[model samples]
Target: MEWLQPTSENLIEGYDEPQGKLDIDRVESKQITTNTIISDFFVMLNCLGERTVSQLPAPDDKVYHRIMEEIAPYFERILIIKINNQIIEVSLQHVKKEALTILNNKAVHPVLDEFFHGEADKSGYNLFGQVPNRSVYKVLPHFIDPLEDPEVQQLFDFLKEMCSVTKDFGFILKPWLLSDELKQLQAIRFAAHYCQDVYLWVDNDTERIFEIQFKF
Candidate 1:
């Protein structure tokens, strides 16, 4: 283990101890595993709010599973992390792409491009309803729970500020009732509507927001 410690710096130079077998293949394997875990963490951070098992190279890896288990409880539906003086707008695939585009052009903003995935269904729950009559719909209260995370909360605050300072960044704050039919209970719903600028909205009837499609 002592010899392994120095390899963390890429300077492998100890073989006196019996435990130090100095197996190059084993060292490379461990390095790859460690890199994979790190890359997966960053990918999760880049995903904003949508995460699927498909994103991982080895979704079945116990170490990866353990890492996700430890951090999943604190995961937000969106990834909002500060980078230097500017915040990185990496979330939904499109928003992340647009952010990359802007970065390519060397431009930035207080708010990332607005992206929301919501649409209507036959069930009569108008999520980001296209029909004029069903413009508004219900939202689950717990959906807002992710905002409690400090970075996400900071992004929300920055977004609110952007709304106040600029006309291009617009959002509608709505309140509705969230009901759990199975649990026979309901709660208050409060969330901002940012998808309109991007031509989408969130549906309220579905508890699984990620499953819904966003209007392109």
Candidate 2:
């Protein structure tokens, strides 16, 4: 199926408006696919006040079973918080873990693997230059230096561009890692691309407030 744009109108279509309101600003649908659609739907459910967990209506195939088994643990860690008269809940760690597991353990498509490594040191900095191993070096020096050398600047620009491309195309390449039966392994090549640390505020009565803070 073609990807669908995630809009406020689409989010509220089937749900009762009186139950909750959607903070659409937090919603983003960059790489669209059935996998992304299912993932995003769950994200929206957590964003709303839906406490129950629902399984994806996937066919009884190896791909479906593998995906479910991989994500099951994360579902167990889901936490729910009520804030400002609204309940907010989300469990993305499982998704990230699953994605990373798939990427690291399975052999990636040659094209996608090339894309990942080619852009690994795009910034031209030596941060990842010393290591010949793409996987190891690609994630090293997560932070960029401010020394401002010409070579370093070039590499940094490359890294930024590569990050953008991955965000745009990663979803398309994910299905390739699935078994022939259409079961996809959990791969997290896109994990670092969307990293954000969350903080919460709790009162004496255990009431909680959800907040997001970014790390440099």
Candidate 3:
């Protein structure tokens, strides 16, 4: 089926915390009355969220692309349905489409993928749930002198671009996460079973999130 933009951006917004307001079971129940395909997609997302807790190694590019392609159409379709029903503002379409493009078009650069080295250490918390807190400083500690290495500089540039894009939206990218210098940053901090100190910093916050693993 063709991908329709989602009715609610919050439902399928990328790199966001799980919705507290949204009781997935309830939403599923209600949505099933209207569209089984959308309800099924919600179920899939919920399952994916649960599976995310395993702290698995990042999927290979091909695997990642396959997953995105498989899901993108559903997200788009859901958004379109929502808009048609007058459930949300029309402005949300741009945001949702941007997300869809990221999923469908963007591939994790080899350098960025190598940042994990292995199982991503799985040691930090932020808006994207328990996924890797992929700060360049944490991931590529060796490139302390980034300017000295052209390759590292290139990677930094890519990260900065990524940071700018994510920051423009309501999400925080690892590279642009709350930094000490960006004191104006607002963040959500909480404790999790695996990590004691977790922070969720959102858009336009000029702060950096320091990985707790390093302090210890």
Question: What TM-scores do the predictions have?
Answer: 0.23, 0.20, 0.21
* Segments in model 3 whose C-alpha atoms lie over 4 Å from true places: 1-48, 51-71, 74-107, 110-120, 124-167, 172-216
Q: Candidates' lDDT values, in order?
A: 0.26, 0.27, 0.26
Q: What are the runs in model 1 whose C-alpha is more than 4 Å off? A: 1-129, 135-147, 165-216
Q: Which of the predicted structures, 1 or 3, would earn the higher TM-score when compared with the native?
A: 1
- List, residue by residue over 51-96, the lDDT tens digit for candidate 2: 4343232222442333343333334343322334443322232233
Ranking by lDDT: 2, 1, 3
Off by over 4 Å in 2: 1-67, 70-90, 94-102, 111-216
Model 1 agreement with the true structure over 121-169: per-residue lDDT tens digits: 2234433334322222323333332222343343433334333323222
